[model samples]
Structures are given as C-alpha cells and as structure tokens.
Target: MSGITRRSGLLLGGAALLSAAAGAPDRPWAEWDVAVIGAGVTGLSAARNLADHGLRVVVLEARDRIGGQLYTDHGFTSVPVELGAGLIHGAAASTWELVDWAGAETVRVRSEPRAAPGTSVDGAAPPREDESAADYLRRLGVPESDWPPVSDENEPLSRWSAAWMVERGEFDWWSAPRADFRVVGGYDRLLAPLAYGLRIDLGRRVRAVRWSGGGVELVVSGPGGTERVRARRCVATLPIRVLRAADVAFDPPLPAAHRDAIAALDATDAVKLLMEFDRPVLPADADTLAWDGDLDVWSVSRLSPTAPEVVSVWAAGEAARALLALPEDDRFDAGLRALGEAAGQAPPDPVRRTTHDWTRDPHSRGAYLYVPPGAHDAPAALAAPVGGVLFFAGEATTGENTVEGAYDSGYDATDGLLADL
Candidate 1:
C-alpha cells in the first residue's frame, strides 16, 4: 500500500468485533484465549466485544487507574471535565450505541480558529472565519509547505494538514457531509461501561511479549512480582510511540516492515491548558480567541453548559512544544497572558487550573500520531497483524485517529481475531 487518504483511514479503523479467551492454565503460567494490553477505550472495547463472543479475557494496564486519557477531575467543577479523550469526534452508530449504553449525553462544542503566529491581539484582529493554516504559516515565514512530503514518511502529516486546513476553512472535517457530537459529561462515560466487569490489572506494565511460534507469552511487572501470561492471541492496544521505544520487547521481534512503519509514524506532541476566570470574559458571540503569541488558541469550554463561566485554552504543534519547554511559572504566566489577550483583559486569579502535558507522559509520549507528508500507508501497515497472534490497535493504528476511530480500531482488531479463530 502506498498512501491512504484521510477518509480511508477513518473508514478502515471503524470496524466492529467480538471477544474470548481460551481455557485456564494449571500453574506458573495463566492461559487465556486473548490477553489485551492497555485498558483505554480501545483495549476495553476490544476486550468487552471479545467477552461478548464468549471469550474469557484480562486487561493489563500500566497506569494505576483504568481510564488511559479519559481522566475527569470530579472536584474541578460540578460537571465532569475531561483531561483527555473528551470529544466523541463523530456520531457513528457504534459510538452513539456505546454512549447510550453508557448513559451519557452529547454537548455541542465548537473550536475557535487558531490565531496565526504574529496575529495582532488588539480589537482590530482578523475577522472570525475560515483561514488556511498554511497561508498563515506562509504569512509568518514558517516553512510548512515543504516538510510533509507526498511520500510514505509524511503522509499522515499531509492528511492532518489537509484536515486542519479544512477545519480552518468553511467546513468541518467529519461534518462536511456528516456532523459530529461530543460527550457532555466527557468521554470517561464512554469508557465506564466497557470496563464494567472485566478484571483490569492496574499498574501492571507489560515488559515484553514472546510470540514467535507457540502461543504468545507476555511479561508484565508491577508493584507485585513479574507475572507472565500465555494466551492464544494478544492484542496490543498501546500507542505506536510506546512500541517504537521498544520499552516492551517482542519474542521474535516485530517484523522489519512493521518496525519501519513504527519508526516512520510521528507523534505530534500537543498540550491543552485549562484556565478558569473570575467570571466569563468572552463575549456571547466569541467562542474562540486566536492570537499571535506563545499560545496558539483559546476557547470558552462551557464545560458545564449551564455555568459558561469556565473555559479551556489549547495549544498544538510548535506552539504546544514551546509551552511544554517553559518553566512551570513561565508556562502559567504565558498562558494567563494568552487568555488575557484573547478575552481582551487580564484573566483573574484561577480558583483551579492544570495543564495536560502529553509530551511528558511516559506511556503516550505525545498526543495523537500524524503521518508526516508522504507516509500515509504507515497507519494501515501498523494495523497489519504480526505473527497472527500479535495484533496492534490504537489511535495510531487507525486512520481516524479520533475517539470514535480509536474505538473502531479496537473493534476492528477483535474482528481480525474472530476471523482467524
């Protein structure tokens, strides 16, 4: 496969599936029909689907908590605020079905335009409308047009850039033909149901997997001693960046082509900062503030629909990288200024605030994966199963690279498992 169109990635990743694990073992080794690594929505969904198919399963999660990025700071507000994977992205039948089963509501939230670098913060700012990010970069002397080639290495970047451009223009990425929705209480609700009964071993970081010939064996360690799992199949629902680090080894090792694809995929480190105001500072009509500053964009979160008092500030690409590099105080100060510039006033002291630094996270290492310019086939290639027993699934494995896409990829992996079974 050469390059996959962004649309293809979205469709390919959205497959449905089922679950199951084989008979139990005697001692030393525990046997399962399938062992799922990572407990995020994709992993949990895959496991749940497998279980539905009468497969016994176990989920091993590195984090002490079950939800990977669907973190909600309950005390932050009366309603839940998502620190990760909050938006539903698209309202697919499967997503809505899961949301309904999980008993969650969808809130309509729109992203304000990202201010171009060097954009004026004065009231005489650019009009609120669709603008090309590439054009903005061209205006700023940023060489965005040259980097992401039309080859395999930079394909995702090219697609992401295209989608990003579409977002800035008179269209929504998923809503051009089909509109999307976000989880009102946050995506945590989406993961809640999937994780209901499955036995998730938290803090159990998988160290290695040996899946060359016989059944797959995974070496996982935690506060307790190292435990090994032998299963008929293993679905690795971890981010590709984690796999690239080789933090977890493979017995026969990933195939050279898979290794190349893994190496080719890029993690666009991103950050989202939450800034509370003494009161709502944005005008009723103004949902976003794009400024020429260290921060890229700021928007009113309306986290709790009724309150509309608090808002979230977000940064991406180089802008997010700059914030991540800042000292704690400087980072907060720069964020405040960006908020002030966008709201047209200095933001009041925050009662509560925090930043989600995806760059610093060990497991994720970054937010989502973006195929550079020319390297589009990597996602599909990454999705290709290894040794039949070793399967891969995650935001990086799918074309959509969104919450819905993640779930779809999980289901698709389960489908693959069922096919081989």
Candidate 2:
C-alpha cells in the first residue's frame, strides 16, 4: 500500500488496453487459481474449458471486444467475410468436431491447392504451370534432396507433398486437411457459443502478474479504474510479443530458458486487408492464389454464387505490414492494383473497404504466431508451465497455429491446470 497511487490513463479505441505508471510488487508474490489473459480463440477456449469443469476462472481481455483476431466483417457482408481465420485447414476430427459443437454452417469448396496452371512468377496474366509446393520451393533455393523425404521420417511434410493432399483421406501441410469452411455469419459467431457462461473482463489490461509467493496477483488497468485480482494460479494467453515486451512484470522474473523462448518465438507482425468489390473481379473457380511477393496468398470468397457482388482480398507477412503503413487512400489504390494484376482485368473499385491495423493494437501485438524455419521446438518451451501456477497458452504455443490449435491449447492448458490442482 505504501507504493500504490492513483494515476491518469487513456483509452484509444475499442480493444486498445493502455496503462499508466504504477508501483507493484517486484518480489515473489501471490498466485491465482487460473488467470487466462487474452480473449482470442485460444484464451476463450482455455477459459471456457476451465469454467466448464467447475473451476474458478477469469479471462482478462485487453481489448474491449472478446474475439481477439477472429474478426469477421459481418457489417460488410451477410455471409461473414473473415479478416483473420478463413479455413478449418484439414478434415481432422478436432476442428470439425468444434464446428459441429458450435453448430456453424459448413461449405465444401473444392480445394484448389495447385497454383493456377501458368500462374506466372513473373507477374504474367496466366499462371506458370501445374507444380507441387515442393517444386515451387525447389525452383527457389531449396534443394529437392534437402527436403525431408516423403516418408515416416517426415509424415506430415510427406503427406503434404502428395498430389491427393487436398483430396479426402490425403494429408496436406496438416495431418488431415478438412474441407475448408467459413463460419456462415462470421468467425465471431464461434466465440459467442464458447463464451456463454465464462467470466471475462473485456477492458481489463493486465500490466503485471507476480507469482513467486503462494498465489498470483495481476495488476489489471482499464478505462474505468485499476484493480488487483488474485488467484491460486495464472495462465497467460497473451500474445508472445506482449510477453517479450515485459509488459507484465513477474515477481522473481521468468526463468532464463522461458525468457529465451519468449524472445525467440515472438510473434511476427502480419496484416490483412479486406476489399469488397461491387462485382466479382476474379473467377469464383479460383479459390486461392499464392503469389510470389512480399504477400503470401489471396483468395476469392463469393460464398453465394447468386451474390457475385462481393469478395475479399487477404494479404499476409511483410506485405500486410507494408499495407498498414500506407495512407488510407494509398491502401485502397494498392489493393485495387493488386486485384487487377492478379486477375489480368480491370477490377471494379470496392463498394466497401475495411482494414485492421492489429500491429498497432496494444492488446494484440501481432497476428497469429508463426514459427520460423528453425525454432520449431521453441514454442513448446514458451508454453511450458512455471511454478505449477504460471502457465502459458496461445497461438504461439501450438505448432499448427490455427484457430483450432489455439482452442485446443486453451482447453489443454485448462485441463493441465485442473489436473495439477
């Protein structure tokens, strides 16, 4: 109480959780039964699972909204246009099982895994030719022999290389590729059902959690006021970037190994721009296109063939960040340019355009986590439990890094916590 003081603060937007100066415990401190930070798919799933089992749980979401990155532009389209997660990835039982549980609409679009025949790397009108992802990589700098053999030694990668990978019973990049489905209204719908009875503080921005003592105490500040919440344990589902920033001060500091993993597995900044055309500019038959540029891929989603008036463009990686840095008018112009370039036709100017600058958002420091080429195992370390109380779970924790993976991690973390208790 000697160091506690009232401080002035500011709130920028819906999900921007900001904090003012504060003096909290720097030494080992209390713990919580469970403190789930973040409210994205992962945090939501973890909190829901824990609460379902009759455990005391509280989900602290830095953003004003619950769904962290499952941003579906329902306002723009009747059929939800996904700005964050677009695919279920594979025909696996877990993700599909969640879909069934959620009771969301499902659609089976033929997976167009191959780059359009003659999909030109040179930015030509037509695509280059039929080629496997491996061939595409080989054409770059990767050696064919260097690739993990398509065998037991590399089951998933091998299966991904199979021609029938996209077809049923064949594995793609993931172990079991399911028919890609979009949550009918929006991915946000998926959040509602899971969060039914969970206790979540929408505007609470957790600044620090000290857990060196018997329990955990979190300093959560928001527009209303700042308060300390206590629990026997805490599960941090905050993005890796937030942890890397040392935003939440730990009592005795994190272990050097955990610190190293957090630094190594820090999330990369990814951007997504959704543009809705007055009329379909690209062929519906072209489900997705993986371009060779600062951008990774783009897909055409005219969910209702009868409604050819709308489609969304998705940009990832450095391209997305670059797009966010541009002026608003320039952003729109650049998207239109990319559309025309991809379709080899004049693209209709968008009737509506929406962009999310997640990088600039304080709550979520980056898009979904990505493991670079080497740090494959680093993610597991970042997720490992600390002192049987301080647990970590999020997109970065799971290797798949999909919505399902995030959900599974939360659920798994909750299960792990309950078992330990």
> Top model by TM-score, which number?
1
Question: Which 10 successive residues of model 1 have the least lDDT summed?
Answer: 1-10
lDDT of 1: 0.64
Tally clashing residue pairs in candidate 1: 26
Candidates in order have lDDT scores of 0.64, 0.61
Per-residue lDDT for 124-154 in model 1, tens only? 2232223333333354454543322212111
Candidate 2 C-alpha lDDT tens digits along 1-421? 0111111111111122111111212323333457788888778777766755656677888877887777776676555577666666545535554454445676554554322222222321221233343544445444544443222112223113222222212222333223565555566766754665566778899988888657688888988898898988888887777777788888778888788777766455565666766666766675554444444335435566765455445555556667778897887777777666667776777777777777777777776564443344566787788888788887666644577778777778777787888
Model 1 scores a TM of 0.77
